[model samples]
Target: MADLSIDFVGIKSPNPFWLASAPPTDKAYNVERAFEAGWGGVVWKTLGEDPAAVNVSSRYSAIYDSYGEVSGFNNIELITDRSLEVNLREIEAVKKSWPDRALVVSLMVPCEEQAWKTIVKEVEKTGADGLELNFGCPHGMPERGMGAAVGQVPEYVEQVARWCKMYCKMPVIVKLTPNITDIRFPARAAKRGGADAVSLINTINSITGIDLDNMVARPIVDGKSTHGGYCGPAVKPIALSMTSEIARDPETMGLPISGIGGISNWRDAAEFISLGAGCVQVCTAAMIYGFRIVEEMKTGLANWMDSKGFETIEDFRGLAVPNTTDWKYLNMNYKVVASIDEDKCIGCGRCYIGCEDTSHQAIDLKPQADGTNKFEIIEEECVGCNLCQITCPVDDCITMERRDVGQPYMNWTQDPRNPHREVTEESTHEA
Candidate 1:
C-alpha cells in the first residue's frame, strides 16, 4: 500500500482525512469514536467564553425527498453548547489518552486581543496539537459579529490570526468563510498575519426551501427564519474552485490548505489533493453516514494511490495546477467535435433529439438495410460545442476529437458577429 500519511504544518496525521469541526467533534466521546473508526484527526468544535454563549433547541433542519433522503442540512446551531471549562477538560483527557492522533481545537470569540490571549493559554494547557480559528460559521455567530463577520473583513481576519500566532503556542490554522466574493483576500490576509495554514469553505448562506403549509420560510424557528449555512455535495464545486484559486495564487501559494465542504469519497479527496489541498476535511457526509465511512475513505484512497504509483500525497499534489489558466491563455485554435461510436450507441436518440431541437443539426441518424439505426456527426457542420457529448447517457459513446491548428488562425478575431469587434474606418480601409 502507498503511504496515505500527511504532514500539514508540522502536525502529522496517519492519513489526510480529518473530520471538520462540527457536531461530530464537539466532545471527546465522539472524537475517540472517530479515532477508533480510522480518522487521522478531529478539529474540536468551536469553543468560546461559556458565560455568554447559549444555544437553542432544535438547532438543525434537513431537506428530504418524498422518501425522506436528506439532500441538505440547515443548522441554526451556534458554536459548541458545552462550557469552556468542560470542553478544555475533555480535550485534556482525549489528548492524553490518544497522544498519537492529531487533536486541533476550533475557537471563536470576540475579536479582541485579550480574549484571544486568554483562550489560547487555556487551550494550550490542554495539550492539543494545533488550533483552527473558526472564521467560517455563517449562522448564529455572524449575528454577534463573530464567525462570518470577522471573515468578511480581511483586516479582522489578519488581526485575529496575528493575535493567535503571537499568543498561542500551537500552530494556528485560519478556517475561512466562503461568503466573501473572493476567497484569496482572506487567505492572503491570514498569511500576512503569520497563520501556519488555512482551512476553507465554512458554509454558504442559503434558504433551502419554503414551508408552503405555514406560509413561511424553511427551517422555521418560532415562526421566523434566518438564512443558515449550506453544506453538502452541492457545495463541492464551489469549494473546489475556491481551493484552487488560493492554491494557485502566487501571493498565498505556499500556504497549506485544509480542503473542506462537500467531500464524501476518495475521488473527491483526490480532486482536492490534485488542486493543492494538503489535507481534506469532512463533515456533512460523515454526519449523514457516520464515522465508519472513514474506513472506506482510507482504504479506497490507499488502493487508488498504489494503483497510480503515488507513494506520497506530494507525489500528485498540485499536479493539475499548471493546466488551469485564464481565458485569454486558452488556445482558441484548438477544436473538438463530438464523435459517437456506433457500436456503443444504444439508439436512444437522446443525442439526436437534443441536437435537432436545441443545437445545430449536426447529427444524422440513419437506418441501415438491416433495420439498425446509427448516429453520425456531420464533420463540417459540427461546431464542437459538446452538447451531444453531455446529453449522451453512455460514457465514451460520444467523445470530443481535438482538431490540430494547421495555421495560427482564429475566426473569433475576424467575426463580424463578435460584439467586441469595432467596425472602424481604419480597419475598413485596410479591408
Candidate 2:
C-alpha cells in the first residue's frame, strides 16, 4: 500500500486525515477516542480565557436532501464553554499519551497584544505541536471583537500572528474565515506575519432553514434563531474553490494548506490534495458517523494510491493546480454534445422533459414498434451543453461525445465576438 503519512510544516502525522477543531475535538476524552480510531491528528476546539463562552441549549440545525440525509449543518455554538485551565491540562495529558498523533491547539482571545502573548506562552507549556489562530468563527465570537471580526481585518490577522510567533516557539497556522470578501488578503497577511501554514475554510455564515410554525430560523432557541456557521457536504464546492484560489494565488502560493469543509471520504480528501492542500480536516462526517469512519478513509485512500502506483501523498499532491485556470482562458472552440447509448438507456424520458422544458430542445422521443420509448439527440440543435447528460438517471446512458469541429483553439480573450474583450491582467493567463 502507498504511504499515507504527511509532514505538514514540520508537524508529522501518520496520515493526512485529521479531525477539525469543532465539537469532536472539544475535550481530551473525545480526542483519545479519535486517535484510537486511527485519526492522524486533531485541532483542539477553540479556547479562551477567564469568562468562557455561554452556548444555548439547542445549538444545531441541519438541511436535509430530498432523500432525507443531512446535506448541510448549522451551529450557533461558540468557543469552548469549559474553563481554559481544564482544557490546557487535558491537552498536556493527551499529547503525552498520544505522542505520534498531531495535537495543535486552536485559540481565540481578545485582540490585544498582551492577551495573545500570555495565551501563547501558556499553550506552549503544554508541548503542543503547533497553534491555529481561530480567526474564522462566524457567530458569537465575532461580536466580542474576535473570530471573523479580527479575520475580516488583514492587519489584525498579521498582528496577532506576529505576536504568537514572537512569544511561542511552536509553528503558527492561521485559520481563515470564509465570510470575507476575498480570502487571499488575510492569507497574504498570515504569510507576511510569518505563519507556518494556513487552514481553510472555516464554516460559512448561514441559516440552514426556517421553522414555519415558530416564524423563526431552524435550530430555534426559545422560538428564535440567528445565523450560524454552516458546514457539511453542501459547502464542499465553496471550500474547494477557496482552497484552490489560495493555493494558486501569486502572493500566497506554496504556503502550506490544511483543507477543511465537506470532506466525507477518501475521494474528497484526494481532490483537496490534488489542489495543493498539505493535509485535510474533518468534522461533520465524524459528527454524523462517529470516529470509526476514519478506518475506511485510511484504507480506501491507500488502496487507491497503490492501484495508481503512487508511493506517497507527495506523489499526487498538487497535480491539478496547473490545470485549474480562469474562465477567460478556457478553450472556446472545444465542443462536445450529448450522445444517448441505446444499450444503457432505460427508456427514461427525464432528459427529454428536462431539456425541452428548461434547456435547448435538442432531443427527440420516438415510440418503437417493440413497445419501448427511444430518446435520441438532435445533432443540429444540440448546443453542446450537458443538461441532458446531467438529468439522465443511468450512468453512461447519456455521454458527452467530443466532436472534431475543425476549429483552432481560441479563448475568450482572443475571440472576435467578445464585445468588451481587451488585453488586461485577467487576459495574461491566456498564454
Candidate 3:
C-alpha cells in the first residue's frame, strides 16, 4: 500500500484529508466520530469570546440541480456557539483521546492584540497540534469586525497573523477569504506575518437563490433572509484557480497550502494536492454524505498512488504547479481539432445546435438514410474550441485530437503582430 501520511508544515496527519472548521468540527463529539471514520485531522470550529455569539434557526440554504442534487450550499451560521471554556475543554479531551490524528484549533477574536494574545495562550494549553486563524468566515463574524472584515484588508490579515505568531507557540495557519479582489495580496501578507501554512478559501459571500413567491433570498428566517457564505461543488474551479495562483506566485511560492472548497471525492483531493496543496479540508461533502466518505477518499488515493509508483504523498504533491502558467506562456503553435465518433453519436443535435448557433459553425448537418440528421465537423472550419465537446450529451463521443501543426514555438511577445516587441537582429532572424 502507498503511504498516505503527510507532514504539512510539521503537523503530521495520517492522510491529507482534514475536516474544515465548520459544523462538522464544531465539538468533540463530531471530531471523535470523524476520526473514527478515517479522517486524518480536524480543525476545530472557529472559537471566540463565546458568550456574545449566538446562532439562529434556519441557517442553511442550497442550490439544487434538475435531479435535486445540491450543487451549491449557503449558510448563515456563525462559529462555535458554545462557551469558550466548554469548547476548550472538549478540544483538550479530544486531543488526548485521538493522539495520532491532527487536532488544530481555529480561532477568531476581536481585532485587539490582547484579545488574540489571550486566546492563543488558552488554545496552546489544550495541547492541540497547531492553530488555524479563522480570518475567512464570510458571514456573521464580519459584522463584529472579525472574519472577512479582517481578511479583506491585507494589512489587517498580516497584523493579526503576526500577533498570533508572536503569542502562540504552535504552528500557525492563516485561513484566507475568497471575498477579496486579488487573493495573492493576502497570501503574501500571511507569508510576511510568519504563518507556517495557508488554508483557503473560506466561503464566497452569496445569495443562493430567491424565493420568487416570497420575493426574498433563500434560508428565510421569519420571512426575511440575509447573504451567507456559499460553498460546495460549484466553487471547485474558483478554489483551484486561487490555490494555483498562490502556489505559483513568486512571492508565495513554496508556501504550503491547505486546499479547501468543493472537494467531494478522492479525485478532487488528488487534484488539489497535484496543484500544490499540501493537505485538503472538507466540509460540505461530509455534511451531505457523512464521514464514511473518507474511506473512499483514502482507498482511491492510495490505489491511484500505488499504480503511479508513488511511495508517498510528497512524491506527487505540487507536480502540476510547473505546468500551470499564465496565458502568455501557452503554446500558441499547438493546435487540436474536435473529433466526433459517428458510432457513438446519438443524433441528439446538441453539438450541432451549440456549434452552429453559439459557437464556430464547424459542425455540419448531413441527411441520413434513416431520415435523421447526422452531425459532422468541417475540418477546415473547426478551430478546435471544444465547445461542441462540452455541449455534447454523450461522454467520450466527442474528443479534442491534437493536430501536428509542425510549427516552431511562438508567443505573443515574440510575434510580429506585437508592435512593442524588442526587435534585435537575432530576434528578427528567429521570427
lDDT of 3 by residue, 1-431 (tens): 99999899889899999999999998888999999999999999999985848888899999987899888999999988899999999999998898889999999999999999999999999999999998898888899999999989999989988999999779999999999999999999999999999999999999999999989998999998899999999999999999999999999999999999999999999999999999999999999999999999999999999999999999999999988877654667779988999999999999999888988899899988989988888988998898999888899999999888898876655677778866454443322
For residue 429, model 2's alpha carbon misses the true position, in angstroms, by 7.2
Poorest 10 consecutive residues by lDDT, candidate 1? 422-431
- Candidate 1 per-residue lDDT over residues 196-244, each given as its tens digit: 9999889888888878888766677788787888887778899999998
Models 1 onward score TM values of 0.91, 0.97, 0.97
Off by over 4 Å in 2: 423-431
| lDDT measured at residue 89 in model 3 versus the true structure, 0 to 100 | 97
lDDT sort, best first: 2, 3, 1
The true-versus-predicted C-alpha distance at residue 272 of model 3, in Å, is 0.4
Candidate 2, pairs of clashing residues: none
RMSD of each: 4.7, 1.5, 2.2
Stretch of 10 with least lDDT, candidate 3? 422-431
Q: Kindly list the per-residue Cα lDDT of model 2 for residues 244-296, writing each as its tens digit.
A: 99988999999999999999999999999999999999999999999999999
